[model samples]
Target chain A: MVGTDTSELNAARAALVEALVRTGDEDRDAFRTVYRLTSAKLFGICLRICADRQGAEDVLHDVYLTIWNRAGAYQPGRASPISWLATIARNRAIDWRRRQARTRAVGVEDAEAVPDGAPAQDDALLAVEAHARLHHCLEGIESRQRAAIRSAFFGGLTYAELAVQAAVPLGTMKSWVRRGLLALRGCLDGDA
Target chain B: MATPDPDPDMTAAELALGVLDGDERAAALRRLVAEPGFAAEVEWWRDRLAALFADWPAVAAPAHLAARIEATLDRGAAGGAGGAANDNDHRWRTLAILASIAACVLLAVTTLLMLRPAPLPVRVPVTVTTPPPLIAAIAPTTKGAPIAAAYDRASGVVRIAGGVDVPAGRSAEVWAIRGTAAPRSLGLLPARGTARLAVPAALRGAMAAETVLAISIEPAGGSPTGLPTGPVVAAGKLSG
Candidate 1:
């Protein structure tokens, strides 16, 4: 399985970090290489949060522009390059979603009805151990909490919005997420 | 396990999860810039949780998108340089017009001196020199009208006029960007009213008519990092 190939993933991660560093030095070609290596995943992120191909495309453009401008700010020691890039993509997508929501009301009911299913079994970009550990830790949490956390992460829903969708009190939703995150952190740290 | 501090950690986790509403999110963002401990906590959450995205199926962007991005970058680079040049051209034309006016004044003075009697104190020849100070209107990107900035070339001081009400816990940071150069911080703008910021000696030479000045909303005492870490509220090119 691709996840089991630690050395290859580590090597790829190293190369991406190098490319990101080069991009920080304002190497346009390195930026292009970074784009080529990561754009698909970032585009997927944009598409999911934006829920529109055209808006995702525009958000993707802004994400790259921001990456180009903020590459120097990337701290490789603190986080993996893919995680850092994904964070930027996710934030930009969320911002786009928020702006769109302001212009036209989004159907909270429609979004809430979407099922929180198990993540499909496929090749993932994260390290095998890390991925396995996360899933294992997730398993320890309540199913509702896990589902809420997953929905929050993937759907970019605020606590109020998630509460409204789940037909639960806002404070209850917040408590579930807070407890879930604390538990997840404890488990992850314990393993280390 | 040590008992976790609920409130701050929960806030950080909420921020990292992108679940905070507008006001709460803004407050968290401010803390991210102002408090190192808070920022680190937020980063810790983000780093761990980022793995959740690994399952997202990668969708290939359209083939044309790469080309489009390259073209956009090219245009951005070219546009930046071209905008600076255009501002410079406009400055020179203004200077020429000013010089012509000075020339006419000089001619009038000379003619008056020539026509006056010798008893009139002999005046030195008037020389038309020194370009007018460069001025730029720094327009806010988010809202409100533009702020006027007047740059004195001789003094190397930029006087900014027009009030911008920075939120209680934030300060406005000034940044200067020349053609193709990264944005350099010009220090923090005052919380309210007009202020003068001196151009650094190293950057003074680069502060031409084409230079672009921007103000970004930052944490109190300005951005902890030298580079701006917040939204650029206002920006404009310098012109004489």
Candidate 2:
């Protein structure tokens, strides 16, 4: 079970909480520590969703700025600190991509470029380490809907974008994701 | 009732899912700020969907960005002329304490969960793949029965079957050769009956038309060295 295997993520989560707590207090050293530990994860999220490295880089800038500004708003027990940070990074990237949806589309050619060869290893912190129940629930859905939801979640693609990309009607894409989401919520809440 | 209008809860889910755009997203974000209940609902969705972020492969932000961010922050702090954070805020201290306590509790709870016995796997969707078009009828150079090999492209599984018998204590190892290059071991084939060998991801691309798939009988447990050591038994070229 993924639940049993979260020791490493939890340990990282624990350290992140300490760093973030100090960061909330405006401790520059702690903020630097937080960035050192997490920039790669946030950058990775931005790069995958945006696909354009430069756009992702721009979004990464906004992400850290928001993180530094909103570190005080994070509620520890309500969500893991890493999840909280990831949500911010992903949302920022999504917002950036959506704003660029019409005028500038992401280039698959840009995405194909070799990622920086530097040691970007997330130290085992970036994998889906927690949420065994959610993993189980996600597994129970149809592959197409599961795939749609996965794409929406990771790529932050809108229903229109998803439909256009998959060459399906907008309504079909919407139904696939919304129904998948509804089923997923039932599966999750049933466990809780 | 026929309309696709979603309720507030679903709207919150969509907002948290990051699937909304234009006016719909704007309204959701407005509601997120105006209504506490709506905000909580969005938070719930965000927390759950954040699980999918697990697959976000870590890419290091260019090193200079952090320094630049700090510089901009420092300038903003100095120029905004606003009071910086005051440590006297009771909420700040409380949050820091909660964070420290949560850290310890998280470690202990995770350890307890790990020690518990494994639960059964939940039912997941099975992706049934059709048999691949590329196949080879590997026949012996001399006189012997032929082994059929069908490569499934999507799954990288090569099904081998011919009902051929193997000599006692000998293994039929499969090798894939491209051009004049040396043979790469595609793992050992089953001694008898039908078996599926998962071609390694690196070798899956090698199973193209005109590529030769060969089998050899070696000491049990296949080749000790990387290259084939025993005599070749059968060989055939894969064709689309």
Candidate 3:
């Protein structure tokens, strides 16, 4: 198990709980802390769903606004704060994907591309650290299964679509995901 | 009959994977939540997939987006006239917010009503008239439900009716995916209300040739990419 400081975790949880309780107004500073802590990761999630930089950022803005408004709804025991945040991120990204389809009328030109750039090495390091610390459970799956799941989850392909993309039978692709999920569930359960 | 337990095919795992789109996904979600094991299954999937996001590329939003959010929040805090505009802006946010909530609520409702059949609310027959033979055929399909869509070949208009169940902060977009070419965006759809979406002219030929019609979740306006940047919620084959 990754060794996280118990005290630090407790403090973060306490603070989040306190923020939830003190609730007449939506707290900007508290939301800021949540934003600073989660934005990059949330952005990463949005990027996967939206498939570009600008789209992800747009989704990120909505996600934060949602988090700020929904802070009071957070339930600690049902899920960890990060899990809740991830849920929000995933939901926003999915919503963005659907809305884009509806807005463009089935073949209009998409918006401008999200800009591309190389980041400083420190940013890479931080992203790597964040990824590893948060996603350790993913490391347990077999490589091929991991690829299939990622293609479906991150790449957003249907099983038939994955079949075409991965050049495998639809059944095989489905099996890969099912087995992969079974393993992942076990791994995550172990972590918990 | 007691709603059968959600088969393995319709599990949240499948939903999160985008295996089910449009009515299939919606129907599955509606029925599956009635199953006792579905919630546990959804929670399991959420934890498993949360890590996949780590590999996603970064999306740096325009400063204006942040400014927009701040402005909305500030306006909301101000109340009165500013608050009214915030409320209007909030209508946009409501779709995404409500969509996620709707998904959850659907899950909950499925669980609650799984054993009981949903009441069929009586709906009045709606009549639609339009200029072209194609438009006349498509209009009636959109009248009753929150979402109705029809395509007219002569006018190259695909009329969409109804609103997607969007979450409080998110929005929905319509997507037209072509067979060979890349998928293109149509425009934003209403969150909870109904709207008519005009399919682009270029897509008319493709629609005649059997194009894929898909709806995805997007930011308020729509996605920048003509291709889908969000999960495909509902999808169908379009015929002119």
Using TM-score as the measure, the top candidate is 1
Off by over 4 Å in 2: A1-8, A72-78, A107-130, B1-9, B30-37, B80-240
Count: clashes, candidate 3: 58
Q: Candidate 2: lDDT of A167? A: 81
User: In model 3, which regions exceed 4 Å deviation?
Assistant: A1-4, A20-24, A75-79, A99-142, A186-192, B1-10, B16-19, B51-64, B78-240
- Candidate 2 lDDT, B1-240, residue by residue in tens: 244565224787887776776556656644643354665566567667766656567787898989877876786565221111221133233333333323221122222333446779966557644544689999876798777888888777778886344567556678777644446667666545787766654455567888788776544444432335456668888998
Q: Using DockQ, rank the candidates from best to worst.
A: 1, 2, 3
Chain A of candidate 2: what's the TM-score? 0.82
User: Candidate 1 residues A70-131, lDDT tens each?
Assistant: 56434355335676677778877776676556556765653443333444345334655666
True lDDT of residue B236, candidate 3: 60
Ranking by TM-score: 1, 2, 3
- Which 10-residue span in candidate 3 chain B carries the lowest summed lDDT? B133-142
> Model 3: how far is B197 from its true place, Å?
30
Model 3 chain A scores worst on lDDT over the 10 consecutive residues at A106-115
Give the fraction of reference interface contacts each candidate recovers.
0.38, 0.42, 0.23
DockQ of each: 0.21, 0.17, 0.16
Looking at model 1 chain A, report the run of 10 residues with the lowest lDDT sum. A111-120
Write one digit per residue (lDDT tens) for candidate 2, span A99-149. Answer: 454445554233333332122234445345334566788889877888777
